[model samples]
Every structure is written in structure tokens, then in C-alpha cells.
Target: MYLCSTMKKYVDVILPLPLNGTYTYAVPDDLSLSVEAGCRVVVPFGKKKYYTAIISNVHYCPPSEYEVKELFAVLDDSPVLLPLQYRFWQWLSGYYLCPLGDVYKAAMLRG
Candidate 1:
């Protein structure tokens, strides 16, 4: 039998602001079991602000350029945005020449 080993997990998230690309954050051990793609998470973005962002991808590759930040909180027990919906949003962002955050903003609009 093969033994399973735990690896470092990272999440790429789409912030609600008008941004171009996803941001990566490190998953703390306490939140690792529950954090996943499409889940909303609270992350500290700028020096003085924290934003609620949507997780777009989860993987083990750590970014080589910058120091990854730790996620503050997980907002959902399950995925809020489905995989299919994420692809559609990606298409919309590309076709419309807008930021993914813009697509996310319009899609998540509340009345």
C-alpha cells in the first residue's frame, strides 16, 4: 500500500476590485481541510484593507516571485461558484476584454 503525504496548498483568488489577474494565498493548516476552489475567502490585500475574494484554483505550486500571504477566513462550506460557471466567467472576461473581477462583480450582483 502507498502512503499519502500532505503537501503545501495554495489558492488563487479573484478579488472583487478591477484587477487583471488572480492572487495567490497560502492555506493555513487549520483552513486547509475546507478551503477549495470557488469558495469565498477573506484575505488581506493591501496594507490597510482586507477583501473577500473568490477562490479560482487550488494547487501545490508556490509562486516564485512574491511572498504568499495566508488566508484569513473561509466564507462557505461548499463552493459558491461552480466549475462550469468559472469557465464561463473566464470566457466572458477574455471576450469582453475586461478583468475577471468585473465579470465576478456582475455575476454576483445582489438586488
Candidate 2:
């Protein structure tokens, strides 16, 4: 007999706000196949508010500090942000001493 196992997945998203660090959200099984880095996902930000955030990383490791929330929805079937653009934003944020969210806001067009 063989044993099968499933691993829990999570994503680190970059919200377009003037805040530092990425937020980790749980990837529901239904959305796991669609979630990827560079893709935008709707997630709860604070009490009574939701925000569209860009996925920065996808992994199985769960955060040990705070309670992780489930993703609200996936905005794109494919990644809207290119890999190069994502890296550029990271570099710009680090070099300029600004938050990644600020870089993302300035780089992306408003909808």
C-alpha cells in the first residue's frame, strides 16, 4: 500500500498600500491551481475591507505568528505582472528605501 499526502499551500501577496512586508494568505484547494507569483488575488486587509494584492511567492510553509486568511478570489487566469517587472519593483523598493507596495502602485496602472 502507498500513502498519499497533501500539503497546505500559502501565498505572500504584495498589497498596493504604503505598508512594509508581504502578507501570507492560505490557498484553498479550489484556487491552488490558479494561484501563482505575479498574479493578483483579492484578500482581506483589515476589518471590513478587502484589497487586491499581487502574489509575490507561493509555498507550503505557514506563518507561525498571525492567523492566515483565505484568499477571496483570483483576478487573473495568468500572471498580469511579468517576472522582470516584479524583480524590478523589488529592486526599486529596496534601493529607494520604500515599501514594495509603493513601487507596485507606481508601476501598475489603475483600473
Candidate 3:
């Protein structure tokens, strides 16, 4: 029998804003396997207004500096962007000195 790691799980999400980094969010029992990279998830930011964010990384390490919040909802049955596209976004952000979210915004808008 195989056992999953005991480490706490967290999902790094890229919000649809001009922000620089992905925010970590806690994964409730109901959303574990349903989430994946490049998938859209609705997450509450600040006091209100749930934003559709892209799941960048999902792993078994919870952040230590702040409280992680649960995902509001997962909106994609299939991933929105491929891993190659993610790599391109990373390049765009680094080369342009822009936020990954900005890259995502530009990518998401291109029909």
C-alpha cells in the first residue's frame, strides 16, 4: 500500500490582476483532484469579489507566513493553457519585467 505525504497541501494561484506573484490557497477536501495547473478557479480576494484565477502549482507544502484560504470554486473541466504556454508566460514576465498575472491577462485576452 502507498501512503500520501503527510505534509499540508497548498495551491498556488495566479489571479487575473496586474500582480506579480501567485497567491497560495488552501485546498479543501472537496477540491483536491479537481484542480490543476492552468485551470481557472474562483477565489475570494481581499474582503469580497471572487476572481477567476489560474492554478499555477499544486503541491504538498503549505505556506508558513500567512493563513491560506480555501478555493471558492474550480471553473474549468480542462486546462486553459498548456505547460508550454506557462513557460512562455514566465519568459514574457522575466524579459519584460512584468507580472506573471499581466502576462496571463494578455494571454487570456487574445481570443
Candidate 4:
């Protein structure tokens, strides 16, 4: 993956909410490395609490609907998760009939 300093790219993130799909956010220049996939970030969702979400992917296209927001903060200097971990969570979520956020919560509690 490219480092965060090259160009400011907007990313479309999938929050662990019961919503439709992804939301767009502006990635800050200084926070490039911190915004990679599997890294957690604080984002403003709706009008209330700032939700912690993972950056699923990065893109250049602007969102068509809602106004994209700036990333509030990145929660990690390096990715907290690996590809295998993500696959494991996906399997657990499917088998347990639970949300991915629930799995994330359980992992956090153990840590």
C-alpha cells in the first residue's frame, strides 16, 4: 500500500452499523499510514456519537449522496488486524449470527 504522504485520498469506509453500505471521508495528509484497511478510526456518524470504524478501502471518486466528512482521528500507528484475522472474524460473524462489531468488541475485551 502507498504511504499517506503521496496524495490526500478520500476513503469509503464501512461502519459496523445496520446501514446500507459505505461512507466517504477525507484522509488527512499526515494520517496516511494510520488510515489503511483494518485500522480503526473515529468518525462522525449522524448527529450524535463518534463511531469507531475500520477503513475498508481508499478511493478517488467523491460520494454521490451525503456530504463526505473528514476523518476525526486514527486509532493505530500500524494495522491492528491482519488478513487472516479479518477472515476469521468474517467466519465467526457468519457462524454466530453476530455483527462484526460484536466480534471486534469481544477481541478488545480479551486484549
How many steric clashes between backbone atoms does each model show?
Answer: 0, 0, 0, 1
Q: Rank the candidates by lDDT, best first.
A: 1, 2, 3, 4
Q: Root-mean-square deviation of each candidate, in angstroms?
A: 4.8, 4.9, 4.4, 5.0
Off by over 4 Å in 3: 1-8
Residue by residue across 2-105, what tens digits does model 3's lDDT show?
A: 22346556689988788988898887878887988889998989987788889999887777677778998888988998899999999999999999998888
What is the C-alpha lDDT profile of model 1 across 19-106, one tens digit per residue? 9999889899899999989899999998979988999998888787788899999999999999999999999999999999989888
Model 1: how far residue 43 lies from native, Å = 0.5
lDDT on C-alpha atoms for all candidate structures: 0.89, 0.88, 0.84, 0.72
Candidates in order, TM-scores: namely 0.90, 0.90, 0.88, 0.68
lDDT of 4 by residue, 53-102 (tens): 77767666656566667889998877777778878977887898877767
lDDT of 1 at 93: 96
Q: Clashing residue pairs, candidate 3?
A: none
Quickly count the clashes in candidate 3: 0
Error (Å) of candidate 2 at residue 99 is 0.4
